[model samples]
Target: MLRSFTKYLFAPALALAATATTLVVAAAPADAAVVSVRVKGSLAARTGAANWFGKTRTIKNKQKVTVTCRVSGQYLRGNVRKTAQWDRTLIGDYISHAYVSGNPKLPVCAPPAPAPVAAVPMGPTGTMTNEQFLAAAIGPAQQSQRDTKVPASVTLAQAILESGWGRSSLSANDNNFFGMKCFNNAPGSYAAGCKSYSTQECTAQGACTTTVATFRTYRGSVDSFRDHGANLKSLSRYAAAFNYTNNPNQFIAEVHKGGYATDPQYTTKVVNLMAKYNLYQYDLKV
Candidate 1:
């Protein structure tokens, strides 16, 4: 369910943005105020199967340059440049590693595949029992007693919650484990979605109707999982969750916090279900 990414090339701390540097200004025509230039390390191209739009740029070190301070959209999109003011601090913390201090001559390094946040507990296919899965899933949770991170198990847990152990009508008939939806006017049989009798829908009057909406269908469970991870990685809100990839319980909790599900007890139910099936064991690996 994970995609490979390139490793970021790094130089010595002095060459990187570990410390602040002076800004330099270049002489322009009389009409133009001298443009400001800042010394900073440039980033190289990023390579990851996950869809993160990042680019490389060089910021000078100790060199003062002049430029307009009010420039917006100067940085690349999807690379912390498009975030709102509130989210800037959060996004910056994750990408700060790409910059260097002294402007050392460093080359671009490819991103590497993300490691599993936790191990997936499994047993022999034939003789394997649910008990084994339970034991394996709890190992990682016990090793790291916390639930504020994102773990691989959390992702699996979400799928199980949405798909009902691959037994839901959506999962059984459409392979739509995550229950995604299209715009209301979407075409084909999905226009109305596979509604359920007891499912509730909201109306303009703010009243609930017993009309369950149709969930989007997928080609397979693998597709659901891949897209699920990609969706999480694409959004800025889930950025912090990636750091907690080593802990599934925390990861699941974060996803819940991120509003991954609409259920009132989404987190509680997910945790309970994982324990019931020993699913936490799946998140114990590196």
Candidate 2:
């Protein structure tokens, strides 16, 4: 009976050993498959992690690419607050997570060391004094006011703020004082031609983004002033903006309320500029 019990003990031991082996096998995790998805927008595949050097190649929207892995990368903010997580392609290239939105389960190989936030540039503003800007624009503003029902003070203020006192490339080169878009969304509408440029606009929610836009060009500064009047006159919906032409302050406020610009403080800016520069004097000429 003792011998029989020992034989049975070995059988039980073997069974326990097999069960332990199975548990061990189950505990060991399997390697995950590399993730791939169709990335949206014109995502640039770069030679390295940073975009400061530019892209090696642009990946088309909705194009398929294997996301071999992920790494922390530079802060690339655009239409969306882009993630600093960089996706590694099958070809060992990198793309910003901003343009590629897909799997959350993708492996992160390292913690992201985000680049330092860049200062929003003071592009075309502050290059000249208010006096300088007024000197350059007062003539055009007065002429446009005389020709069109638009107020001279309001026009000058808008030109100063919009064109950054003629420091903006559009105003300096294309002579687009109002930042008027190109006709038919392409160039060749006016005498001087047009230019396709990148435009940044503020949304209602206060989110700012960039988009490619074409703007009308002019033969000269006076022509730009003439077009401003025509553009306002042509827009039937903006007729209410012309109602208070005798009152430059009132006119700017009305135009702002009528959606002349996306900026919420447009009326205030124009009004303040007028006061600061004593631009109201021009309105009296009308």
Candidate 3:
């Protein structure tokens, strides 16, 4: 009777182990099939899912690539399809699925954790003298000039004029020395956010109007100055100003003509400030 009881206990344990193995096998997913697809056109394979990542390589038109998986990223309208999906090549590079010739279903990539917001450096504190303001602005202006081809002299002079030598509420509060408006409060890479302020706008004909406007906010004065240069460079109207980068006077004139400010004497005011301060010394010689 003792021998019979032992056999029954062992039989149940063996049966349970066999049942658990079958359940584990059934729960496992099938391996994703790798697919070879032709690129519809010249495509850049980036290091990550987004175009903001540095390029790893260029995939030429009709080049075949083996894609192992897909992930969502920056939206793109390509010749084949408009999508935000990006494909992961077997070699670990990412290319937009929009550029791939055919729709290929693949396993979704595991999403990465959200990135941290960059810490913005603090700017100068309290009221500053003209000399102090110039001292603070010179470095950022020259850097902006080198990056955007906008004259440092023009940038410095505009800051002085627009921000009232860093005394304006916009400058002191938001660090927006250039009075840059957030048209529709649209998102921008450089802007921290938007704020509302009462402002005066004038027409070329000297017709002035007072109204409330939305303006871009920055983390500090450096970002404000940098965004000013980038903003000017991005607009088609200011395209002519880039050509005169070596000439601050001509550059400011073109900028004024592009309707940067509604003030009729905007160019003259900036030019006068440039000459008075001799700010041209900071401009990069192109």
Report lDDT (CA) for all predictions: 0.44, 0.67, 0.78
Per-model TM against the reference: 0.40, 0.52, 0.57
Instruction: Look at candidate 3 and tell me the lDDT of residue 272.
Output: 93
The most accurate candidate by lDDT is 3
Clashing pairs in 2: none
When sorted by TM-score, best at the front, the candidate numbers are: 3, 2, 1
* Model 2 residue 245 distance off true place after TM-score fit, in angstroms: 1.1
RMSD of each: 20.1, 22.5, 18.3
lDDT, candidate 1, 86-138, per-residue tens: 10111121122222122222223224379867644321111224354234334
> What is the per-residue lDDT of model 2 for residues 1-286, given as tens digits with 9 covering 90 to 100?
9999866744653453231110000111125536655644455678777676557777666666766567877775433234576767778788666544433456666544899975422222235675776776666666667678788788888888888888888887877778887767564434477678888887777677888877887767667777777777677767887777777788788777767787877888989998998888877455
Q: Least accurate stretch of 10 residues (summed lDDT) in model 1?
A: 84-93
lDDT of 1 at 247: 62
Off by over 4 Å in 2: 1-130, 186-191
What TM-score does candidate 3 get on C-alpha atoms? 0.57
Ranked candidates (lDDT, high to low): 3, 2, 1
